[model samples]
Target: MKKLILISGTMGAGKSTVSSELKNILPCNVFLDGDWCWDMQPFTVTEETKEMVHDNIAHILNNFIKCSEYENIIFCWVMHEQSIIDEVLSRLDTSGTSVKVFSLIVNEKALTDRLFEDVKKGIRTEDIIKRSIERIPLYQNLDTIKIDASNISAKEAAQLIKDKLK
Candidate 1:
């Protein structure tokens, strides 16, 4: 059986960074970022877009699960709610796949610092800080594993996930 690893967090919680590092550490692994499915220029957050994005993510994930070239699959997204997670998971064919989900949490200061750096790099706008922070609490109390990502590099976080999977 293959492994399916899903990493979820807020906008500045290093989900993409750690997901990339995990790909580097794992041999024969396929990595996918959920943002790639929702890369609309105007970026509207309607229910229709949400459903479409989830469908797209599920389709890609099912493909990855069926592919034999990859022993492990990694995906990163800002999944703040359990219902969203459930919906995505329900769409996957996991008959021979072991799925693991991790949620990254950071201190408020660390999150703000990361968001500021993202803004400086032109990857994120300043208003994203407020929006990201507002969803932090919603990420907790879920069924997924939670990791404190306050003072770790992406490589370190990936190593932690690799260790946990072992």
Candidate 2:
């Protein structure tokens, strides 16, 4: 059976970085970052755009799942809510897939430091720090494996996730 790995975390929690490393270590794998679906100018967050992004992600993931060339489908995004995860899963044909969900948990200080570094480098604006920090506790309530990423490197985090699969 193929594996469908869903990686979730607050912004700046290294979801993209870890997922990238995971794709490298996994055989016949494809990585999909949710942000890529929402890469629109003006970055709108209206209900319509949210729906469109979800549909687009589901479409891409479903196509990947149907492809026999890939044995592992790795997806990462800021999936802070159960409904979002459900919505995406509901749209996919995962009949023969073993699905695993993971949330990258980070300490407040560590998250703040990471976001601040991104801000300093102009990768992200300073306003994103508080918003990202506020979503930290939300992951605790999620029904998924939690990886403590406060002190670990992205490669280490990916290794931990890969170990969990075995």
Candidate 3:
């Protein structure tokens, strides 16, 4: 059976970086970032757009899951709530696929430091720091495997996740 690895965390939690690294380590694997579904100009956040993006993600992921060329499908997103996870999963045809959910947890200090660097580099805005930091505690309530990423590099985090798959 194939594996569907769902990685979630707050912004700046290294979900993209770790997912990329995991892709490099895994053979016949494909990685999808949920943000790609919402990469639009004006970046609207209305209910319709949210529903559309979720549908887009599910559509792409289902294709990947059904493809014979890929054995592992890795998806990462800022799934801050269980409802979001459930919504995405509910749309997927996961038969014959082992689904694993992971949340990358980080301490406030670490999260702040990371986001601040992104701000410094202009990768993210200043307002994002506070909003992202505020969501740190939210991951604690999620019913998924939590990986404390305060001090680990993306490679290490990916390794830890890969080890857990065994």
Candidate 4:
């Protein structure tokens, strides 16, 4: 049977890292990172842009769900709100697929440290780090399994999800 794994988390909580590791560990898996769909030049996070990105993600995921080429479709994104999760779930066709949702969580200290390292690596800026940290609370009370990523490596977190799939 096929499976759809939706992984959500804060910016520095290792969603992308875990997704990559999960893809490596799982067979016939298709990995989709929502950020890839929104490679906008300006990169503004307006309401309209959010809707467009979500629509694009949903459409692509819908196609993945319909395809039989992959046994597992892994999607990672910052689904900070329940409504976004609902919207994505509503867009998918799960006739013969098992769906699993997981959220990676980290404490503020760990998050700040990670984002700080990212900033030092020149991949991210201070403004982005502050903004991401500010939005950490948005993941609260989300309707998904929460995995503590504060001290775990990406491979370890991927193994946890892998164990769950079995």
Candidate of highest lDDT: 2
**Residue 134 in candidate 3 has what lDDT?**
93
Candidate 4 residue 22 Cα shift, in angstroms, is 0.2
lDDT of 4 by residue, 1-166 (tens): 9999999998888999999999999999899999898888988999999889888998998889888799999999888888988988887788899989999988899999999999999998888777788877777789888888889999999999988887
Query: For residues 36-100, what per-residue lDDT tens digits would candidate 3 score against the true structure?
Result: 99899999999999989999999999999999999999999999999999999999999999999
Q: Report the C-alpha displacement of residue 160, candidate 3, in angstroms.
A: 0.7
The list of candidate 3 runs beyond 4 A from truth reads: none
Displacement of residue 98 (Cα, Å) in model 4 is: 0.9
Candidate 2's TM-score:
0.98
Can you give the lDDT of residue 25 in candidate 4?
97
lDDT per residue as tens, model 2, 92-116:
9999999999999999999999999
Q: What is the C-alpha RMSD of each candidate to the true structure, in Å?
A: 0.9, 0.6, 0.6, 1.3
User: Whose TM-score is higher: candidate 3's or candidate 4's?
Assistant: 3
Model 4 whole-model lDDT (C-alpha atoms): 0.90
What's the lDDT for residue 22 in model 1?
Answer: 95
Give the distance in Å from residue 76's predicted Cα in candidate 1 to where it truly belongs: 0.7
Candidate lDDT values, in order? 0.92, 0.96, 0.95, 0.90
Over 1-166, each residue of candidate 1 has an lDDT whose tens digit, in order, gives 6999999999999999999999999989999999999899999999999889999999999999999999999999988989878888999998989899999998889999999998999998999999999988887877898988989998999999998887
Better structure of 1 and 3 per lDDT: 3
> What TM-score would every model get versus the actual structure?
0.97, 0.98, 0.99, 0.94
Report backbone clashes per prediction: 0, 0, 0, 0
